[model samples]
Target: MVVFRSGLFFLAFLVIGGAWGQTMATVDRQALAELESLAAQHPSSKALVLAAQGHPVALVQGRATVGFIGLLNADTTPTAWRTWAQAHEAVFPGACRHGVASFRVDANHLDVLEALPMDRLELASRAVPNLDKARYGTRVDSVHAGLDLPTAFHGEGVLVGVLDWGFDYTHPMFYDTALTASRIRGVWDQYRTAGEAPDGFDYGAASLEPWEIQLMGSDTSNVYGYSTHGTHVAGIAAGGGAGVGLTGMAPASDLLLATLMVDEAAALDAFAWMQDVAEADNKRLVINNSWGLPQWGTPDGTSLSNVFIDGLSEDGVVFVSSNGNNGDSNFHIEQTFTTAGDTARSKVQFYPLSAHPHAWGQNLTLWGEPGEAFSANFMVTVGASTEVNQSPWFNTADGPFMLEAVHVAMEDTFVYDVVAEAAHPDNGRPFLQLRIHKGNTGLGVALQMTADQGTVHAWNHTHLSNDVGNWGQDFQAATSGWLQGTPAYGIQQPACGESVIAIGAYASEYLNSQGTEVGGSPAYFSSHGPTLDGRLKPNVSAPGVNVESSLSSFRDGAYAVTEEVEFDGMTYEFAKLSGTSMSSPAVAGIVALMLEANQNLSPSDVRDILEVTARQDQATGALPAEGEVEWGHGKVNAHQAVLAALNWVSWVGHPTLPDNPTGEDLMAQPNPAQERVLVSGNLSAQSTYRLVDTRGRVWQEGPASPVFRIDLQGMPPGVYVVMAWDPELQTSHTTRVVKTQ
Candidate 1:
């Protein structure tokens, strides 16, 4: 469920949104086309107050609706409408003439959307004057040590667009000023013409905007519930000028709010539209799209692609979307995101390794079979397997960890911590004990819904205590280290996102609730990567736990949690939300800062900054793969990224060779020798050299190049690298060589 700030929905609902104030009806193409043909007999469809994009006025067939919903088209002449209606008497019969389907419309209609004009939106730099602040580095650890919110990605100047639920733009935490036509630049709502829902809300005859709701309802003006998701994400991107919790990553970047409100088809079109416009506006835009179909299938049709990504490349936009908390279940993925030729990474989750063994079954049970039918039972409690003395040493032996079974019950569908402890057997180091916490609870009064509501999410109270790979088969059977999605065969989500920085989730200590500088470990549930095509995703990681940012749910008058604040004459509460969905934007904000420092850094450079600056995962003990999961390069380190952005290094991702090799030197003469090339020593008896072509085809091979020659007579002229492998001495080297006349 989308979260909201304390005591704030009364007013929010007044505005308008999905399902509540909308309607859907499929049109009859055959009948409608006939009506259009008649309407064409007139001047234009617009003349009838309901025109087709290019059709003319005089072609009419009949009226086609049962009650209040019917089509509205033009009639060239009053009598022609009757003449056409007479011909199609079979289908239209009695109600024949007027129009086919008509949804009531006018000034007060909910469908008369007050959509922010697409062309009217502007870039963000117009608002925050000090937007370039982060570009100038200030000591992070010494003065502002903690989760460095500001450092997550400097955003004083960059522009970011959020395609999420919706936002309460007026919130002070979000710099609504930046969202106006003048501030951060452009703002639009393609789903609305003047901000209206399909079915108008009958609030005593007139619909009300959230502003109007504030006057009549009990909702707070500052913190709204329900659709405040966009607002919260926006705050994380860049909110400023007040409060104590934390500031966002890019405090000055402009934001655009494009409402979807159940129009999935139209929204995809809008995504494409925005890409083109942002580029035209000279804004190197980054998008935060926290949505996707609940399911994905093979590329059976380019249907979804044409509207969302057909011409995205020329626009140079990048995006990051959620990998759905639904995890493996409900997530039918197997197809991958592979284009004939495209770049930019896409990311998803990477479940972590937990120390406890029982965590495996527990974790899988929750995520593996969502929407599946199953049964449950309990095992009887028994005495310690080996009866010990009645002394303290006697082993209770059964607990939350690995152990013999005690009494187990499935009284409730609730999942519990599978822990083991020593009980009553006295001092026998405690025996295996299975404790049962009972009942029907998950996802809406059930353990499932409760989990989705973000109440004590995974990697928090619900996941394994240790990494799953710790015990190998002792825990579970071996599978490739790849993070595969379930029903793994068709197109997976987000992987289809074109250039947006698709990020996987991971924890970082560099950002605080307010984006302050703090330090910590990685979040466990963040999506892992090496997308379908094997590109490391999740541009980078940022602190996504215990985050302190703007409040967008529950009202101020609502009950206060551990800490409380008052706003707009009300008091409310807050908590930290953790997920890769959260981390991606944090990085977006950081990228904004990088650009503010140097506008020349290409999107590729921006990507490299995050990857190269990453500190090797201290826990994983290996570098992230160039096209695999686990730490993508490593947990992001802003200081390092900033350094590389400053050209303190030669390139991104990895450092340039130090201008000289570290050890003994090896050289090759006539390197690309067509007939045979001479090689000198970097000696080791077991060393091997293989001449490989671009397509990975090896032309010749030999052991030890103390002074050997290679013949490549039939090979084409090109550039290649000679790889030297040594097994006995455990050494490897690579040198560039050229060939041809």
Candidate 2:
């Protein structure tokens, strides 16, 4: 019985930035000691401390100042203060129940204390998700669609390890009866002695980063309850099904739970306990993590060196993580933020650079800013009444060298929705004419503004501002009605990082009474992609609307994505909240299905299948922007994907096979070119293998190697095999490679 819990019925969350190849470094034993010492300098100190169980304060500073703990407590609660102690009972009766000690500051005096790794504290939100009902046409579209449940679960003997905060072991869904001795099933909790110490992962030793969502506490057992982020993410991996809630991608698959039980958010291993478990239960397969930190904390790539991240991958785990919603809130790829860029426009493009030499009090140029969320080449002119109207015309004097828009055209613009763009629009061409948006923080789209009299340029620190150049000139200044947006200022960089897959939101065809979906689209908050690395993140698109999922049972028990939507003349919160987070899971689930169809399919192989097989029918009927740098391949096609995984007739150098992949006749693509494909009329590449598909798309390409061979996704299903006449890799002798249909 715990008296007071900072966050009950909820567990910690993790961060998986775009580049997940990193993790925490070795703790400077000296640094840890010094931090502890500094934290506990004063006898009255009540600083946050590291403990085996959940973090508990031994002697809280009480209210303000700051103190620290010198040791990692592992014993039961002390009865020094029987009165206060008795009031708070341990939530769980176990060894690692709770390790946290809550108290204010002991004194305001300065006290040398040990400093745990410090990171900026912040909360990130993703674009709501939705299903592609148009492509699917139904909830269970996979049945006859590109990839279905059975095909995806081909990896019945395979495994997937999930690293996150604590889970709800007692939850009905997690306690699937069909698992126990089944071919694909597992559940374990190193944190709690009983039940499933659902959350927390391997944070080596007692090291935790400041911004880390979870921290080491005294009360370890029964620590986590219902974490929205963790639960939602895990649900995508393997959440229990539901009558009203959404089912998981692999409803029948096994689950390996690892939670990082720490207070601070960024600790690599909240404690070695979780790590020890994962190592002992290593299955050499796939692992997904939907957690990461802001790009600012790691200007360099050092953060990608976390030992745990690599160790697991080395042991045969395909690590997956969220690309981060920091584009707007934190240092994102686009220059525009939610408080600024969200508008009633069809597009929300990305900007590359954001530089305010004199305004930001610095000369550095930020490259990860989010800009417009629309078409790069789209332009429009409107009267002062059109919504989402924007014109470069702001300048200093408003506030250093900054820039702000009062009425890009109109008001009420929300999440790319035309909430209020008509306010300034004219009959066709209004006086307040302007374009929608431009630029990505990574790629740096710019607006060279020069103070104009009426629609001049300007800048301000406030959340809202206007174009002030024309303000004082016309005399009627104040009453003249500001021609907002046109900035008469300097240059604003646009299109910074343009090489990656920058994702956008789209709604599913199926709509609720409120026109919502299980996972809808144009997620109001999913930060647009296209990183400073010029890599278009989210390579493809998915539904980002109202998706149904398991509830926290603690935090907002209602539907997850939206507050509530009207369906069939009735209001319901049974569906999940919408966002890219939801969309990503859908894709992840599909990937699992693809693997299930083929045991030999590798991560790369799965990625290729999805990209190539995905449909590219935009409303414009335009093919998906081809290229590995952008759209990768196209929209996901469960039907085609399942077929390809089953047919298993493909090539490595290119996506398409030669005209006749038989044993004799042959044709060459990009014929007489540097890189060409040899389509042997005969399936005679000289490789031996049989491609079998139980449910989803699966294949055995080359001889058995940890990694598999591949070209890209988007392969159609058919009966034909590939014979790789190339080298037999490890064996010096000749070998036969085959691909079965």
Candidate 3:
């Protein structure tokens, strides 16, 4: 039985005499009968029947059918569910939080899932990462120079985990500034199956030791091919320059690279793996996600992936993601029906052939206002007045879980599929999907729609045969249509996730060949957003345009190499790329610096500091107090953010310090002093004191008698730690102090 409550729908299935039945069913019987008829004639139609009946079914690896299922009761543990799944020959990858587990089974075994006691099932669509930054413009250079503190902050002791693909483990940029030691701690290649997987997981290969990664050299190519995306993103976040003079935002931070399998469940596993590694090493972790897709979740941030991210945020792990690169694409349209039976129409644009291997159609996703319903149909037109064919109307209310129809017009045949839900279980909005196959027909395609009494929002994306990627296409005002699309609400998930910091892109200021100042405005392609739920996304913007970073030497694809260097008898290359994918890592590197300043900072604390210290200028225009769609809180100010982080630590008291004082609490007078600092506190006699920078490099150490003076002359300004130890009492006390130039 499926019941609608508080705008959301819940499913409760009952079995009668070894057959599945619904009580108080919401599915339209006529639509179901039509779907059944189609299934009998087409092998692909069987998957549609499963979908229309409220069972999530998806094609995995172009062969098997897979989905995620939620256990019915608290008594049914994930362990027991996995056991049952294994007995039925179903592959249970792993269990997720909130009692949900993912399964991969043959198409023939898909029906067996119906017999299990489950509360909800969903299609686990693979996420397409936003692919497509830099230094001085964000004021990171000022922080690196220690302009007004005791020691420079280079994200030392911080772990930067990048979840991306196409990593060259042997890239020279992964080495330290001296080119002697590698900064990468580990690499989890989820596509590799020969070697041992990471502990606590059953798939993929893990390269933990540095020698092991070097032995592998690079990850095997996947669907995206032997790409350079991951290496480039990681370079922007933490590359050590390798004598290339292109320093990343946090050059001293360690790296953990995961070449994801492109699915949400696999992504969750990567996060868990990185967290475990961070915990074991006792270092703060920051994960950079430069990829996302709308199909992974509702734009409102209620998907399982979002829930998992929120949980991780509470555990002190920070997440940063790209807002996407569709700011200039007219891929969205919205319509409101004040009275009953209001209608709207628009032409659907399809990408040119070979844009992608699976680019054979366009997908239109519709979301209606709560408690309201809408109906949609597809029309094939010849020229301006002739209608070649029109498919049946599928209403959101009482529609089949899925419906597929065929229309023949002379020598052309058109096939369209519809997936509808009266009320979404997550946000309670009426959701519908229309996938129209281009079918080698050169004719025109358009969408006709009507709503009974509410507003509906629709987004058009290139529909790939593999059901991955979310590249958008335009919707134009056709001969008989008045509605056209706009480039708004373009932020993708998990950037839309409530706790994740979504970053936008802006071109760093530079001088043109004419000697005129240019740039410093939002990148035309940076995704815009005040998410569907009216929450400001792109928490802030960063430098992303024409940003120079490292390229993978193992990449098979041709690239425009900007510079080349010979390191250790091998030539490495660098190149410039642009997209929100670039801007996201710039912010992730800044977050690492903030964490270095105060290891106790939460994800929210990091976001607040970044926003409060963000800079607004002519490029961003005059921004409101709450931020805007394109620029968010304005451009990131790394110098101010680091200062604020230090202040935040002071206000809350350093987490590493002892709560009670034992006449050993250390304090420094005239902190941020230019010439000298007088160290005095509840110190014991014969105590020895050492002044060390954030990087653990000791500046001065000597025997003390409760009070001493340390000269700050010739020392770079930044944050530093002062520690006092009383050997007689076997006690030590530590506190932080700042120095100024």
Candidate 4:
């Protein structure tokens, strides 16, 4: 029997016999241990512990605990679970197509849920949003400059979806370039519960129309406190040149916004909702994720969230994410042992509680190669030499999960907990996680490790009260044998995923008194990457340094206002912010333009186009063909990328190509013709040919012979459609051809 405290009373649940016992036997031991640790650390909130079940906890209406539950398999629907929840008096929020669902339950009834067969149960992990753009640096201005040809793309007919918080829906930047109408197709506020949720989901308020968002004014406040992050990101991706005269990369694209719940699970829900909206509207969608959590998953991109993003990518939804902003922080260490009995040591530096009020302590995450093991312990010291207390050595091979805390008393008490694992199920790597609490302000912390064989990587991250941010801490070589940390492998989860187009940050160009000049360098804080499994990441780089964009007027605190605009009796503002978060949207907006040019392109196709068209200059210093750790494929080139997209459409067969009944293919020689194209196949003397551009305007129409030549001498360079109608068979065959300059 297990006893759980619920309010003033205690509830006892049986987990020893019958079907309940069998279910408990199959539960993930690591997850169970994590939950037990949380319960022990926070005994006062038994309801919170039960609801979280080792996951991060979010309180709904200040009472119920909400978390995610993964079903046993794809065959198992959430319907049965919903029924079970109802019998146990729990609230089932909704279900996602990936066999995951959200549930809210009281602490007392949580034990009943434990008896149900489940593949996994995850509590939401808190995530911080990454916070762009000099469009000319990426040549996006060239695309917006317009071409004399018919193929002019300003992200028209494409959907740009942003998943972040702090949006001022009434901002003029969300409207059309003429300010005559709103371009925001919809907005889903996951934290607000007073309105209708998006279709197919039971939580959050959904404003499908622009008028609804205008009435609400702003989303509900979150931990960030009426943030301006989401608004700024959106403005950079697709904001019209409303007030600042600085237009986003995709100014003519439609916008779909979602103020997330600051959790991994909620982000998944947002993706599903956005995709559904795009499908309903019959438009291609590109989602920009400017936030990430380093502690949330394995950095090799095999985590559930990474897999989910990959699945979405295959379904035609493109995902772009920020690599991270920890490039300047020395928070990562990699050590290898050539012989037995090799040891490594580093002194942990904790962030002060004064600057970070929610700073609980620091977390040291250590990972070793498969079939290899390592033992680690923490040492507390007074000043530089006096050892106050030393934690017990916890070896990863000893058990799947081990939890212990070290306590010491001098002038004040000092304490910290150690959580070790024999092998993480995700990648079969030996893992160790330590949560060092801020006990005595004067105590010093250090980590010591020993490994028999193989390499190990460790990262030190500052743990906040809500687990929302992954701000790094330094590892100093305080002692003779201690090693100093480096800034390599700083890319976080989601960004490390194979299918996600991770973006790095670079400084944009600006003119100084010394004449036209460019920053033309990687941002100091842009994270470096080559995922743990050794895969090149940060597919491309974009401008992220002090880029100007819209700001939320509803922000509660003081902020530096760079510019302001007055419209309809409301005052809106714009400001400059910097981070990888800003750069991801710049690429996403460019992706919108590519999609506008060719809607049939897949996620992989889009990635290839961006990489092949990326620009490399003196600032990049002759990067390798495979790309570099910091700059990826160098700076993004929007003009070349869109042109490549258009060219690709011609080869893959255009979407507008009509089916031919003649059982013969239409052919054009010198497809990318410089001056003329030879049209042949399935043609007759009585055939009439029409040459049209992308805008559906016929450039040439005339009678054709079996082997005819179409002159392209005066026509502008662009993709053109060629249709030939055979009057004898009363059939038409069409093909797309590219005209080069």
Task: Between candidates 1 and 4, name the one with more favorable TM-score.
Answer: 4
Q: Which is the better candidate, 3 or 4, if ranked by TM-score?
A: 4
Residue 475 lDDT in candidate 2 = 9
lDDT of 2: 0.31
lDDT of 3 by residue, 640-670 (tens): 7888687553323445434443443465655
- Candidate 4, residue 540: lDDT: 92
What ranking of all candidate models by TM-score puts the best one first? 4, 3, 2, 1
lDDT by residue (531-586, candidate 4, tens digit) is 88888888999999999999888988666888888877888889889999899999
Which order, best to worst by lDDT? Answer: 4, 3, 1, 2
Name the runs in model 1 displaced over 4 angstroms.
Answer: 1-154, 176-225, 276-281, 297-310, 323-492, 496-498, 508-519, 553-574, 624-627, 648-741
Q: How does residue 605 of candidate 1 score in lDDT?
A: 58
lDDT of 2 by residue, 403-505 (tens): 1122221232211101111111111100111122222212111222221121211121101011101010010111133122211111110111121112333
Which stretches of candidate 2 lie above 4 Å from their native place? 1-46, 49-155, 175-226, 243-245, 262-284, 298-302, 305-315, 326-505, 511-524, 556-574, 619-633, 646-741
lDDT of 3: 0.75
Evaluate all candidate structures by whole-model CA lDDT and list the values in order.
Answer: 0.37, 0.31, 0.75, 0.76
Best by lDDT: 4
- Residues forming the 10-long window of minimal summed lDDT in candidate 2: 467-476
